[model samples]
Target: MEVGQVLHMNAGTGETSYSNNSHLQKKVISMTLPIIEEAMTNLYSSTSPSSLVIADLGCSSGHNSLFVVSELIKIVEKLRQKSGHQSPEIQVLLNDLPGNDFNTMFKSLPSFQKNLSSQLEAKDAGPYFFSGVPGSFYGRLFMKKSLHFLHSSYCLHWLSQVPEQIENNKTNIYIASTSPPNVLKAYYSQFQRDFSTFLKCRAEEMITGGRMVLTFIGRKSEDPTNKEAPNSMWELLAMALNDMVSKGVIREEQMDSFNIPVYTPSLSEVKSELLEEGSFSIDRLEFSEISSSTYYNEYNHSDVSEIAANSIRAVAEPLLVNHFGDGIIEEVICRYKEILLGHISQEIIPGITNLIISVTKK
Candidate 1:
């Protein structure tokens, strides 16, 4: 299936839209702040570009997208102030698949700019330009040696398409406890190919000394079957679909043929790919577990479960609609909430492992 043309979060600022349900992603950006700050500082110190051309690939439309850009600008402005040098003009490119809700994001830009302007009104910051560039990041999206800084958060783990060989991974949309060993191999191979292409594309697009800070969901174990509910949101989603199938709400054929286009790589796998790609040098690589309940402290257990289900629904509903039509959307989400409520226990509220890597163009 052509995943790019169909895959996107639920559009607009509705109840299930990604814009309102992206608290987990927002928390991730907040958690990784120090790493990003360091990466931007290193890039500026090395290149000191007069015009900072920044691109955020897979920058889905939402507050999180603007949050990332604003943080980078703050870092650079601080750097220029410290050095007493002229501030550089900033060019921002927000990229995603063509199906993204760019209209919603674009409409919010005036407010974003207003807030940014007020914050920097008294400070020495350069002109900030914003534009949307819609496309996949697995290939070239910019001219050669054009980007000075790059960032993507919670995006790289999404494969450009599902692994072709996973047809036999029945009754499951992603890697699950019942998935065969071959399923793991297929997913890894797809990740290798996609990630290599991503590295190569960015290497060509970025100038020497350009830096990238990427953070995406991953797993601590090499065994895909060992991933818990927090990391394998798709697995829970598959369970919900299977429940519908049992109730005759969805066909078995639908469940059997579908596979999520995502892979949760181990840290070693990511490092290996970077080393093999041979274009970028790893400056800082780290893995950490953060609670999925980030920013949900005031929410009760039931509220949290619904929010969690909505988050997954926002990301997966488009894929489901493309494959199964819109008939099953509401029922599947309802069932997904039940599944999440059941799986959530009184334990530590399992944290999702995210790998954060900062690399420099060689």
Candidate 2:
């Protein structure tokens, strides 16, 4: 599948929309707040730009988008207060793929602006500008030296597209223990290329000494196919698809042809890419574990599988529909939910890792 065109979260404010089902992503953003604060503080301390330009790459439609912007505004306000100067004219850019639900995002802006005005009234912070830039971050999306601080949460793991050569190797939807060496190599090569391009683009867009805080799914193990890492989620998802294939809900060939355009890279992989890119210095890198249960605390239901299925469906349903057609979406999700429910246990479900990295432009 062409990921940039087809890979978007479920749209609108419906039950399965990303806006409704993004608590897990919100948790990730919350975890990275300290890193974000530190980066912005360091940036302001060093340069103290009178007009701070910030961008939130892959900013999906939701409260999380505003949450990031609001936090950065607060940080800048505090910095200005400490320096005894007026807060900078903050320009916030929210970016995502072209197919993102920008309309819904725009609709939410009036309230966001009103709330922001109220919050800044006492501090005398300047009016911040917010706009949506709809496009892929895998390529250039902004003018050179336009951005000061960049933040992306739960986004970088998605590849620009599935590897072209792996069309026939359909044993799984993602890197798995059963995947062959060529399959692993293909995924790694794609990640290396895509991440290098991402860094290069950002380097061109950011001013010298600009800071970035990125958090996404990643693996703790060196092996790409390690079951203890995040690949286990895909393994379970693959099983769900396989069960459907056996029941004739989807073709075996279709299952083989489909693969998720995502990779949970190891810390070493990230460090090596940044080193090779030669435009950024790593300030901090951390890995943390979060339970699947953590994402569903707001829900009244106790079934972990139901929660897990909903979470995955919100992000994966659009892509699945693109590959398997609309008829099979509900059935596939239902089967996947059943499979996950059967496997839910007290072991904290393996293969879920979170990576947080902070860097500065050289």
Best by lDDT: 1
lDDT minimum window of 10 residues, candidate 2? 293-302
Error of 2 at 35 (Å): 0.5
Report lDDT per candidate: 0.87, 0.86
lDDT of 2 at 240: 82
Residue 105 lDDT in candidate 1: 89
User: CA shift at 48, candidate 1, in angstroms?
Assistant: 2.4
1-362 per-residue lDDT for model 2 (tens digits): 67889988888888888988897789888988999999999999999788989999998897777899988998888888888877789898999998999888889999987897777645567768888898999999999999999999999999998986886567699887778788899999999999999999999999999999999999888998888635777777788888889988889899999999998899999999999999999999889887655654455443667767777988998988898899988888888777666666444466468989999999
- Runs of candidate 1 with Cα error greater than 4 angstroms are 121-124, 229-231, 292-297, 345-349
For all predictions, the C-alpha RMSD in Å is 1.6, 1.7
| TM-scores of all candidate predictions against the true structure | 0.96, 0.96
Q: What is candidate 1's lDDT per residue for 1-362, written digit by digit as tens? A: 79989988888888889999998889889999999999999888877778999998888887787899998988898888887778899999999999999998889989998898787744667788988999999989999999999999999999999998778899988888888889988999999999999999999999998999999988888777876544467777888899989999888998899888998898999999999998999998889887656556678878878988888889988999989989999999898888777766553356789999999999
